[model samples]
Target chain A: MAVSQRALEAAGLGGGRGRLERLRQWREQEHVFGYGLILPALVLLTCLVAYPFGMAIYFSLSDYWVGSPGQFVGLTNYREILGNDVFRQTVQNSFVFTGFALTLKTLLGVWLAVLLARDVRFKRVLRGAVLLPWVIPTALSTLGWWWMFDSLYSVVNWTAIRLGLISAPGPNWLGQTNYAMAAVIIVNVWRGLPFFAITVLAGLMSIPREFYEAAEVDGASSRQRFWHVTLPLLKPVLAVVILFSTIFTFSDFNIVQILTRGGPVNTTHLFATLAYQIGLQGGNLGQGAAISLFLFPMLAMVVFLQLRYIRRD
Target chain B: MASAASVRARRLRAALTYANLTPFVFFALFPFYFMFVTSFKRNAELYNLKAVPFWIQTGAITDHYDFLFRRTEFLIWMKNSLIVSVIAMSISLVIAILAGYSLARLRYRGVGSFGTAVFITYLVPPTLLFLPLSQVVNWLGLSDSIWALVVTYPTFLVPFSTWLLMGYFRTVPREVEECALVDGASRLQTLLRIVLPMAVPGVVCAALFGFTLCWNEFIYALTFVSQSGNKTAVVGVTADLIRGDIYYWGSLMAGAVLASVPIVVIYVWFLDYYVSGLTAGAVKG
Candidate 1:
């Protein structure tokens, strides 16, 4: 009680103790205090996230353009995009891009993380080296990839030819249909690999050494130990990494935009690049918003299911 | 002895790890090296069909770097990126610190739901919101300006840094905070003076990580700002440096290298904190 009185006094609430104390007491309640604390974040999100999201949905439903806000057509934009061949191809491209990129990143990421977890010399340097692609700006780094895949004076082709990996004048990476998708996927994997490896490495480091030793005592081979022990423990971390990476990969713009610009006949456009083309560049805001929001439902469901899965533990 | 064989096995495993790591490391690093090498080489060496592509046989030149600064607004773009990143990061950090503390420590109604909402917001990519946000930016008269980014970047940064800092704040001992409160400190004072100092690492981690995200942000930067003066470094290089069919390979690469080097240097200084921040967010978050 004395401490409470002193605290109130220190808060400059001694005079008019009745109302002041009551007000202080009211504000001091955990619920009110908590709300007050989070109020700034709440305001920022409501204005920036929630409000814009609502606007995005509205834009998708209406026949809006950059200059003119058209009347609401009620799913006409969605229907129109669903009927468009470019949009259809983009849908297919998004899945193929996300699917391949995620698979490669997962496989290579886990393998790299395992290698990183070893007690090797200069471990920090090696880890930093591996993370270069991830830490550098994506648009900037993708520009480098664009150069390497340049049709003329291509280093990738030069090296490949030197090593007998491919014949003279290799497939035009960004220009060809199949290789355009392949090029985007390769860059995506390269960029995403460090994220997976480092996050999973953290998971790997967290596992008790005794568990591995106990498995070893049971005569489990190295592969068996990884299968039974490391894999199970790494699931949550992997899930979180994959969940985030999936969203990032699906909405990837910088790689496709800078490298291909959804080019080679739009064979490599993801939802973002397609949305940018249709909405921003094409001035069809309604269709663009519709296309971009196309993945929101799927992503939300993934987040919902994955959150529940994580919360189970 | 079995011990000798075990040592041999371990050495072999170490050797194998190195061998496997070599290819991945090369894939990660070769691009940067190529970019750097390309940036310095003259047009003669850069365009030469016969010259070796791996390294420059001809001497390096600053012609590209000279062009980047002299002919283009590379410096201005970099300045925009720096300003946007620092200001946005500072704002998000302050907001995140408050929300993280409340979510982590306070016993409140709907706190759980609020926590989940923040996490979900982190999942909402800018691509989905950019169309509406472009309008919103225009509505507020911030379009074609750095203020547009300063205003919207927080939509993503706040949620992520808030969630991460919640995990960080939860690790801070409640007893210390309580002690401060009992001694006549107000709640706000306690948070600012007592709790914040202890979470310095988390704060630094959040700042460095958030700054990098801001610097690296592309789509919003590309879409929101269009004028040459207002563009961020990443967008400026891609948008301006590549004119027509004639590729400015040397200057474009110079721009890429210059844009990437600042982030690379910052990460090097705080690499462990970056990892620790991730572990906290991934494992605890």
Candidate 2:
């Protein structure tokens, strides 16, 4: 009887060990299959992103045009762009556009989120309506704005005249340096605010009601509660909004191209449109590449700082 | 006491509501209102330029629409855009879902950290790359072809699509897949029959994202497609605007309205999914 019972226990142990081995083999096979699954993405990225990056770095140093023979210029292209007044001004304009656009959008977005959070009539309609400009393609909408600002026949001019806001139809909006810049900035802010509002609304929703209740119970006014309670809670989303807006505004080409085409004597030029004009249109590939090379450092600094803030949040 | 408290709360809520919404309502809707009114006016009326049109002209003509369709290459551009967008969206969706599932569920050597790192590459600005890419396109002999856009768009699409799909795939329970494996199903079979159907929302979300990204693409489209007839709708629309002394404002607005229709419909249909998809991984900094 003892030998029979010992044999039974040995068989049970052997069967359990076999199942474990089988499971291990299955896991190994799954891992292999998993790698196979990711093979397409890996290959696509390597060819599309990685190769292009290496090529960009190489071309930045070479004097290459669309139809002309390429020659190695080696830092000359970079130096030329660095010294160029238009390039420097564009870099400055990008910062200005980003700074103003981000600040206005954030304030307006937060205010909108706060409004939407309260009970209001037609809230659903308002919510849907607010996202329209953002939903519309930037190219199409900016084109629409272009017609509105037509120097020959501007509706805004007509209206301002009718409303007695201005004495005459006024100067050519697209021709003037300052008004053109202001128009583009306004369009950027208008296009960007929906994203900000929706994102900030989501952020506001994540904050606990108890914080506001606590603040109110302590006899805090709405302003006090906002500064002390809402602002702190909303920091992470605000940071993200600003960061994304900065990146997008910095890289923006469509609106500027449609409206001004970096015109009014290049007063409204940004790095991206200028790069396109110099490189592709003017047929100076190296110079265009040089203008764009600053993209990496500028974007990296903003992304790095914002990412740190986000991580802390 | 309860009645007084309720009344006070109602009044406070009303005031709060007004305060929150006053700026955004005007901010969002004014441009749309302006566009609608502009589309209805005759050239003379449009040129007359008033603050707002006083009357809705039953005489709003479809002449601009006719001009856009017949006079310009608008139809062809639209057709090319549709063909390109559909193909790109379908490819990205399928590839992204498979890769996202693999990254989310399966363990491989160095896959975990590497997957997240791969996603960061999406944030790299295209401004730096387009010039060199133009050279690469020239070398490949693909300049002035729609096919060039097809090749390059996936660079942007795949990373975002994969990231979104990965986040989405994580929310699914593992037990569901285990059951499929236990039933003698291969991983592919399980992914097809069990994983995909369950992950339709995510797949749909990825498809929409891919579709929009390809649709709204400009820089590469502008750089690559050089021929006038070969231009995409985005490039084509701008090209159409310059016909020397005859700026077709009505047709342009009509085209603008037309271009946004498909996307607007998409938004209206699947807004909740679209919003969640766009904003999900976006906040991760």
Best by TM-score: 1
Q: What TM-score does candidate 1 reach?
A: 0.96
After superposing candidate 2 on the true structure, give the runs of residues whose Cα lies further than 4 Å from its correct spot. Answer: A1-30, A306-313, B1-16, B19-23, B49-58
Looking at candidate 1 chain B, the ten consecutive residues that score lowest on lDDT are B276-285
Candidate 2 lDDT, A1-313, residue by residue in tens: 3465466568776665566657656754977788878888888878777788787777778988878858888999988888888888788778777777778888888888788766678766777777777877788888777876888677667677778988786768888988888888888988888888777877887899999999999999999999999999888788877776677788888889889998887878888899899988999887887787677786787667765674565
Clashing pairs in 2: A115-B20, A158-B49, A159-B51
Error of 1 at A185 (Å): 0.2
Q: For candidate 1 chain A, which ten residues in a row score worst on lDDT?
A: A12-21
Question: Taking the candidates in order, what DockQ does each have?
Answer: 0.82, 0.50
DockQ-based CAPRI category assigned to the predicted complex of candidate 2? medium
Docking class of 1: high
Across residues B43-155, which tens digit of lDDT does each residue of candidate 1 receive? 99889888999998899999999999999999999999999999999999999999999998999789989988998898888888899999999999999999999998888
